[model samples]
Every structure is written in structure tokens, then in C-alpha cells.
Target: MKLKLKPAIARRPRAMMGKLASAVRSKIEMEKIRRRGGPARIRKGPPEALLGLRRFVANPRQFGGFVSGPALAATITREIDPAAGPVLELGPGTGVFTRALLARGVPEHNLILVEADPMLAARLRLAFPQALVLACKAGSATPEMLGGLRPAAVVSGLPLLNFPGREVERILAAAFSFCTADAAIYQFTYGPKCPVREEIMARMELSAQRTARVWRNVPPASVYRITRD
Candidate 1:
């Protein structure tokens, strides 16, 4: 008998067809990129020098600035517990650390990225649309910047050593004030030792210990965990 067609059975085939279409589309896109050059070929540089006059005006010692090595970036983000609340990333240059943080299970919505360079900030906003990206000086950021949100961890890519002594102190204080009591600050530096000098550490009522050394990175670098005693 010409009997019964169920609605569920009709829907199953359509759903399966949709899945097949998606898989085919993804494969085509991958092949196109591979045939070109690679994913890197599709990427573009910032529209302008993000760091601005700071790039030419500051001396090497005064800048203490280095984009974080990929290995070191992985280490810092790995230490972040996924269960922790939102994370605050300072001076997220070109979003190296920002990408690592996402790979480490921190949701994009839970990240607040503060970048001082206008060009870099714009790039970050485009690259990480899910993150709460802001173009502002780290030292000048207030708790309200996050819309009254409190971060569980602060991961900074800023060149702390290059900052003047007072500026460094102010940045640290502002970071600590916004962070939860148990929150930790992850910072990487190529300096001889921790970026936060002994005096600044004491004044901030914080202490830092080296967490990892990434020798494969350019000029090498170390990750430090600063926390309140």
C-alpha cells in the first residue's frame, strides 16, 4: 500500500544534505587558499604605524618593547583557568597574545583588550570582534572601561621596563585595583630579570617569580607571574 511518510524522516534527509553542502564549501575555500600562497598571504599589515611617535622618539632602553614570542604567548594563556572570569590583556600588540588566549579556552566575549596604539587598536577590533577592544593608555584605564566588569586575570604585553618609574607604578596599581584578590598578572619580558623592578614590586605590595623561559623566542624571553602577597 502507498502508506505512510513521517515528517521526521523527511527532515532527516534535508539535514544530512545541509551538512554535506557545508563540508564541500569549507573544502573549496581551503583549497583556494592553498593554491594561492597560504593563509599568511591573505593577511595585511596595519594601515599606519600603530605605536606612532613612540616608535621613533623612544630609545631601545626606554621602550623595553618587544612583541611577545609565540611560545611565551602560549605559556601565559595556558596558565589561565578556563573557569576564571573575563581576562584583561594590556598592550595587545598585533594580537599575538590575544590569539593564544582564545586557543587556551578563554571566550572572546570574556576578553577586554586595551591597546595604546590607535592603528593596532583598530586592527585588534577587526581581528577580535568578540573581544571588548579599547584604544586607550593602559595607565589611564579605569574600572568602568569594562562596563563595571571585574576581570579574573590580567595578562599584559606592555613594555613595563621601558615605562618611566612613576608610569609603571601607576599602571600596576590600576591593574591590581581592578583585578580580583586572587587574580594573577602574566607579563613577559626579554630583560635581564622580571620587568617589574624590586622597588616597584614592593610599592605595589606585589611579588613576582619567573614562571617559564622561552629560549626559542627572538632574543629569548621569560614569563613572570606577579601576585599580591
Candidate 2:
């Protein structure tokens, strides 16, 4: 008797075509941005332009609060205890801190990233498929968003002062709720003082102490280790 052969399984042409198109678009966009010196050009003459300029002036590597420098990211990551259970990185932008955390031996699976910008979030997801990436406001991160994942440390790249006082407090409160009692929260600011003011700190029942000043960074930056009382 002659042996029978099974028919080959066909792949979805549309799906495959869509993926190929996306890859091509991403590569083209990266090349364009690279030639322009960065990703995402700033829109000038708008009211937000001033604020964006100030942020950029403070940290040029971040491209107007879109990301943080690798050195700054490494320093912030180093502040967290190596034995910490997991790390929650807020506003991970272009995955600067995410890369730093991974370099410091934080498992990709152990990292949870909260990013607001859709473009940046998509890039981060592609860069770190193992990470739990959520595209949402930090303040709106519910327990479900966390998917039962608890973090041992919270590292923030959020422009706290740029946000409304109540909004900032809400985000910080939500972040703290997901952290352990002794969990450390590392934040950096270009301002002369800590970004979280006394009132907010008191309201959150948290205390912040400056850990290091990195003058080598553009406009200089200070790192604060915030913890619950």
C-alpha cells in the first residue's frame, strides 16, 4: 500500500502581511529618527512647547521628558536592593530604565512597566516581551492592571511637578499600595529640591531622603529614596 501524505497547513496571508508591514514601518521610522538625532520630534510654538523645552533643557537625553539617561537609570536601579522581590517602573519611556534594570540582573519577567504614551509603550513591549507592560495612567492602575503582581520597589521617571498636585499624589498613593511596607521608591528630579513636596509627602505618609547627586547628567539631577514611614 502507498503511504498517504498530510496536506500542508496554510498560514494567514493577511496576518503575515500586516506583521511584515509593521516591521518595515518601524525600521524606516527608526532610521529617520536616528538621522534627526532622536525619536519623536518636539512640536514647537504650542503652549506645551514651553514646558517641554524646560524638561528637555533639564535633561537633553530624555528628549523632553520622554526618557531618562542610561547612567541615571543605572544609578536609580542600583539604589534598589538586589534581593527586592520585583520592580515597578513608571513612565518607562523608551526603555532606558528598563534596560538598566535588566542589566542589573532584574529578570525581564519581574519588571512591570507603566507607560502612558502609546508609541513608547508599543516600543517597550516590542523591546521587552517578557515584561508586563501596561499602557495607562499611573494613577489609574487598578489591582487588575497589576494582574496580582506585587512589586518590591517602585522606580519613577514621572515628571511629578509637571502633573497636578492631586494627580501626582494619587499616582504615588497607588504605586505605594502595590509595594511592600519596606519597599523603596526611587525618584529623580532636576529641581534643586525633591519633587514631592512636604504636603504630599505627609499626605502619603512617606519620607524622602536624597541619595545621590549626579552632576554629570545634563542640567544635573538628584536621586531621592522615598519610603513609607
Candidate 3:
């Protein structure tokens, strides 16, 4: 099915494609510089940070600031197995967590990035051409979106507390549907508790436990892995 975003958020016209092209070229150049053992110049903001900041400006209701740090991103994704079918990432933002998943041995083709912000989705497609990029709200997700592919693990960078309880439940239900019986949902939250509330987890027949805490983050964050058991 074709995914659509609110027209106001996807303000990118054909003219904006040029901006995407420039960003892609800059990313490639940075990679090449790293490979050559030369230091690349720093940008005002990292791609993921910039994407998050931009999206937040567009709609703070949809996004919190990007993942506080790359370490946090890598930490949340630590337990996922490479062979666990395709990995479905919720609110991948600018691919920060996506990059960590790839570095952890998850293949590019195994990734399915769901980004609500249309501009970020467009940028994600240009940045990670091999992965599936869907521009739709995570709460609107359906099992049909997976096309028979089951997920080994679902990693989320979504800020659930900013959303209503019902919306949170819907997003969790959708993510868990595509998971194997043993699959897990790894989610991070800035708040003290699990990102998805306990009652919602109970309603979905899922359980969660705190896995790690990133104390160095600005507001600190914790990771939780939800399971069917």
C-alpha cells in the first residue's frame, strides 16, 4: 500500500530534491575521507541530529530530539541477532540507530525503516538506498506492511510519552505483530519507566525489562526489550 504523510510535513517540492542530492554527496565524501584516514570537516550538526532538529521544528509532537548519542543507539540495538529475519526500525529518524544495526551485522537489505516525517524519509532513502523507507506514522502501521517478512527484532527511537495512550498501544501492537514468538522490541525512553506503558504492554500480552541505561546522555535514557513471555 502507498504510504502518505500530511502534506504540510512533506514540504519538499521537486526543487528540494536538490537539497537531498547535496546531502547525499556530502555523506559520501565524509565516508571517503574516513576511509582515507583523513579527518573530515565537522558540520553544524550530524546528519541524524540535524534531521531530528529539523523534524522537531516541523512537529515537536512527532519527534523528541534525535537519539542523545550514538553510544545509546548502539546500546539499544546490542541484543538483536543478524539472522532474525528483517529488522523493522520505528522512528529511525536520520538512521542513527540504523547505522548501529548495520555495524552490528544486520544487512542493509534486511532493514525496513519507518519514518513519519516525509523529509526525513526522503533523506533516509538517499542515505541508505538499500533499505525500505516508509513515510507513515508508526501508529498507522499494519502487518500487511511487512509483506510476509517476519522481524527478528524491532528497534524503536520513538518518543512515546509525547503521544496519547491509545496511539502508543496501536504502535506497539503493530510492531509486535510482525515479530517472531521469540522476537524482541528494543525501545529507549528519556523517562524513568518503559517507553510503552505497562498497562498497554499487558493489553498487548507483552512484557518488558530494562536492559541498559545511558547515563551520559543529556537527560539520561534507558533501554528496554519487550517480549511475548
Candidate 4:
């Protein structure tokens, strides 16, 4: 029987290939920045866009795009209390949001970054040696992954809309387990509604509020503060 190409699948490869090409270019730029000795500082020229593209090529469903610009990242991390306790960052791709948390007075040692990409995790270790970096998926986050530190806040960059309902629930539950009772989960989404599923939010007794909308980002995005009280 002759097979017909599914439109979505057929278009995916070309889009992914183009993204991979851009991602490669972005990696080259990162290597140069790494050599210059300040990996945390964001730079112009195919930086966030390239990293986002590369990640999109690797896992389109799991990432919307990189933290577009510092405006959004800084906004997402605004509520984290640097001295209150440790902070857990999910999918700290290219460390843009990670840098923002650091800029906001969070201690390097108190920040724990969980990144699914081994390559990115390796670079994060070199960039922020004091910060703990775990190379693992969001679905597998646990207190053990954080070396037993209870996080005061959770700042996530994981693409929730790309995940199935179960996976999203699992990731959220795991991250929240480490947070204090009144802590917040900061997330950014490009969609019209919150990235988190409404049912999951209701089930988890979480409340979400859009704190900021940043048009300066590559594609405009809004930051949501998710809290469990």
C-alpha cells in the first residue's frame, strides 16, 4: 500500500533541520563566549535565538523557545527570595534565566539547576561552578537531585504545553515538593493562557496570576506566578 505523508510530520523535518543549522551557529557563538571567560553574561548575535532554535530542533515539543530576553527572565525571577532558601530552576537552557536569578541576589551555591540536556548541563557547571547542576529531565526531579535542600522557590523554563498532561503533572508535583508552603513557581508562556493545564492547577490547589507581559521578547510572553498556599 502506498503511504501518504502526514502534514504535521512531513513539515517537521524541514523545520527541525533549519533549526538545527541555526542551533549549530549559536553553539559556535557560545563556545567563543566560553573562551572569552564569562559564560553567564548574555551577548548579542544569535545567542538566545540560536540556543532556542537548537533546542527546538532537539526537542520541539519540550521547549517553546529560549528565554527571549532579559526583560522576561528578570521578570520571572523577580519574586525569588535570595536569602530565604535555595532555588530550583527547571530546564535552565543556556542559563539566561539562571543569570537573571543570580543578578537578583540569589547565591550561586543556593541555586540548583536541573537541565535535561547533558551538553548544556556541562556548560552550566563550568559557567557557574558554585551552583549545583543536575543533568536530568523535569519528570524526574526529586529532593535527592537537589542534594536534600528544600527550595524556597521554583523557576521553571520547561515548555508545559509541549508535554502530555501526565508528564506536566509529574514535573510540577516533583518541583513543588521541595518548595516551602508559601513559595511560588515562576513560569513564562507565549500562549494566551497560562501554560499549565487548568485541571492540573485546580487539582494541585495552585493559583496562577500573570504578573508581567513583556513585548520586548522575541515573541511576546507573559510571566505567571504560580503559588500553593
Per-candidate TM-scores read 0.74, 0.72, 0.78, 0.78
Model 2 CA lDDT for position 164: 75
- Return whichever of 1 and 4 wins on TM-score: 4
Model 2: residues with Cα > 4 Å off, grouped in runs: 1-67
- Report lDDT (Cα) of residue 136, candidate 3: 96
Q: What is candidate 4's lDDT per residue for 100-172, written digit by digit as tens? A: 8989999999999998888778878887889989998987977776777988899988888788999988988
Candidate 1 per-residue lDDT, tens place, 98-179, comes to 8888889999899999877776677677767778988888899998888977889999888887788898888888888888
Report model 2's TM-score to 2 decimal places.
0.72
Clashing pairs in 3: none
What's the true lDDT of residue 160 in model 1?
83
Clashes (candidate 2): 0
- Compare the candidates by lDDT and give the number of the best one: 4
Q: Model 3: number of clashes?
A: 0
Quality of model 1 by C-alpha lDDT:
0.79
Model 2 gets an lDDT of 0.78
RMSD of 2: 14.8
What is the C-alpha lDDT profile of model 2 across 1-229, one tens digit per residue?
A: 9865544323466668899999999999899989977545422234333544564676554343433555687888886665677899988766667778888888989999998767567767776878899999889897788888889999988877677788878888899889878888899888989898899999788899999887777767888999898
lDDT against the true structure, per candidate, is 0.79, 0.78, 0.82, 0.84
Looking at candidate 4, what is the lDDT of residue 181? 82
Model 1, residue pairs in steric clash: none
